[model samples]
Target: MDPLSDILSVLKLRSYVSGGFDASGEWAVHFGSHEGIKFHAVVTGECWVAVDCEAPVKVKAGECFLLARGKPVRLASNMAAEPISLQFLLPPTHDGRIVTYNKGGEFLSIGGYFTLADGQADMLLNVLPPFIHIRNEPSRATIRWCVERMRQELCDPQPGDFVVAQQLATMVLVEALRLHLSARDRDEVGWLFALGDERMRAALSAMHASPGSPWTLQLMAKKAGMSRTTFATRFKEKVGLSPMEYMTRWRMILAADRLTNSTETLSEIGHSLGYNSEKSFGTAFKRVMNYPPRQYAKL
Candidate 1:
């Protein structure tokens, strides 16, 4: 698999918001929008997640739930069952889009947008489950700390408090994801686990270390200490792409970053990445990115 693609799958490129609501006698909050990922953290209250397609999932304090794919869900408190307060940490938009929150009573939350500027974050996203419910496990100290920091930042009326709070909140989410990947079942292979494997890690490192090298299946297989057929099959199973396909994707990813961050001529970038000529590089770049190199660079 292309490490860049894997990483992007994990890094959510959307806006986020964090806040809380006091449930007075079974009040319910309905979130109905095709926005970004929505995360509900039960900081001090209890609630139930009622969705149309699935049974209602109960929530309690110190537990966090993610509503992936921005599916519409309802959160409610049933006084007849349990008494709980509701806190939410959610994206502000879907797909870098914008979201508006009509401020309710003393809701304490933080939110921000996430984008994968590099391969690391992208690899993490691909392995994450569609919805992750994190119990207050022992290994989640970092996540807890981040969440507490978010609460502190949200409460503090300091200048740039929102900015600081949002950053912390984002960090918390990232850490949570990291914890999830580390503890995820080994049988459920995801891109993150693939990158972490010894063999795949070495191959990926080699590719990144020398993107312009004449990488071949034989060479990669040798580096991985596996037979050519074994290497190819394993790589495909783990990465969801052939070796050359992964290489091409990585090259395009590097090219896009260069286009955005550097002033190098397109031809120079092409040559740097082992392209024979500017036109050849341009064609490859366009095919992968759906934009001319120069045009993409301007963005």
Candidate 2:
């Protein structure tokens, strides 16, 4: 398989937001939830982030956090400590505007928002500890450089700097994820480790290559060179879904994309995805997505 294509297929570039702030203050940002992922970096100063949880998380410079499920969250400086200068990243909206605040002080920071295009991204997300701190470590030099470049872009505000900054910030996010994966414990077992396994990887490849295929536990187990019971147990333990369940999710994901990007008839899409009829596909799609395929397609 083409690793590059595999990587690109599972990852998507969203939007990046970076800024500097002086003094302690609150900033409100508006972001619509998409079936995507989000990564935030505290490039400079120190701040606190609160996301529908009790209290806030104290995040220092060079540290990063991810909201892989695209939940809405709030970020602010730590008022209890010294006033923080801060910067952040987020996914771009249709208007290309990021909601934020600068309370007039010396602060520098950068942030990027991205979507996981493939299953690999989900693997990477799973291995990351709640918050990955990259402070005062030589291994974090690359992250430091990304932070510095973001500061320069914010300070200079040159032509197209906004675009350039966002692109670089996305790169930084990807690199950070790569670093995290490399440093993860070898004994760590999760969907990520499963994906790295030759047998499991091959199984996943088959499923993704043909979500509509009439997949069976025995067939999948044979493909993975394991007993059916072992394959089912292992697949469930790692993926949190049965093989058939995962196939359904995958089909829905593809259906959502097609609904948004294509003009195919519902019947055609349903049949292509292995549904016996458009009505059956529509029923399953609604059960999973809470909207009929045709209605969802319009959105």
Residues 77-170, candidate 2, lDDT per residue (tens digit)? 5434432222233224422332234544433345556666443355445544544444436777876777677767776768898887777777
- TM-scores across all candidates? 0.73, 0.64
| RMSD to true structure for each model, in Å | 6.3, 6.5
lDDT of 1 by residue, 1-299 (tens): 35434444333343344454433443555666443456656666566776546778777666677655456667666524532222242353432212223433322222333444443343444455546677777776776676666666555556776666566656666666666666677666655566656898788778877888888899998878899999999988877778888888778877887777678888889988989899999999889888888888766
lDDT of each: 0.63, 0.62
Candidate 2: worst-modelled 10 consecutive residues by lDDT: 82-91
lDDT of 1: 0.63
lDDT of 2 at 107: 36
Question: Which candidate gets the maximum TM-score versus the true structure?
Answer: 1
